[model samples]
Target: MPTVRSVTDATFVDQVLLADGLVLVDFWAAWCKPCRAMAPVVEQFAAANRSRITVVKLNVDENRETSETYGITTIPTLRAFRGGREVASIVGALPRKALETRLRGVLGRGAAQGPID
Candidate 1:
């Protein structure tokens, strides 16, 4: 089953920005309650959409350079990137259905469920 991998300032470019397709990066920190609350949902979403997108987590506290570059002042900022550019972003902790709807709106119907990879 697919799982949300961790990305850092050192690996962000290769693992996300330069990745082949869609990549959903969850920017968060250990002290963030909302981030913790949204973890399971992110995990499930990643597993369900494994074949369509790559999911990863970046800890803001540990990855300051990447966080500052992205201007991520909020916890649980979800950014969708493709072709080395960010296409969409969502701030804060949204419910599962809300997250799906928002992502679908930006990503289109192709964001449908896929086999775990």
Candidate 2:
């Protein structure tokens, strides 16, 4: 099953920013084909990394404020946050292996142990 949850502008701060550990926010809209195609990939990644990260989805069309704040000009943007700040971001749909690799590269080792390096 997919472990990803949805967050809105009203909940973005408490859910993603003030959140503990690492949080991966998927900024996407329903109409975007790439975003839809990436859903399963993201869900699988989330399930596999459940112990290390918290995954959530935010629809750009529904939450414009948060999207604008994050300077998201494109869809399917995946952002990783740690210590209430963005530590990494990927701006397009990627395969599971690539996604994991990219995130691991940016987050580095001991990612779940503490703040992102």
How accurate locally, in lDDT, is each candidate?
Answer: 0.86, 0.88
Judged by TM-score, which candidate is best? Answer: 2
Q: Model 1, 1-117: lDDT tens per residue?
A: 449999999999999989987899999999999999999999988887788889999999999999999999999999998777777788999888888887875454232433221
**Pairs in steric clash, model 2:** none
Q: Which stretches of candidate 1 lie over 4 Å from their true place?
A: 109-117
Point out where model 2 deviates above 4 Å: 106-117
Worst 10 residues of 1 by lDDT: 108-117
Minimum summed lDDT over a 10-residue window in model 2 is located at 108-117
In candidate 1, the residue pairs with backbone N, CA or C atoms under 3 Å apart (3 or more residues apart, or in different chains) clash, namely none
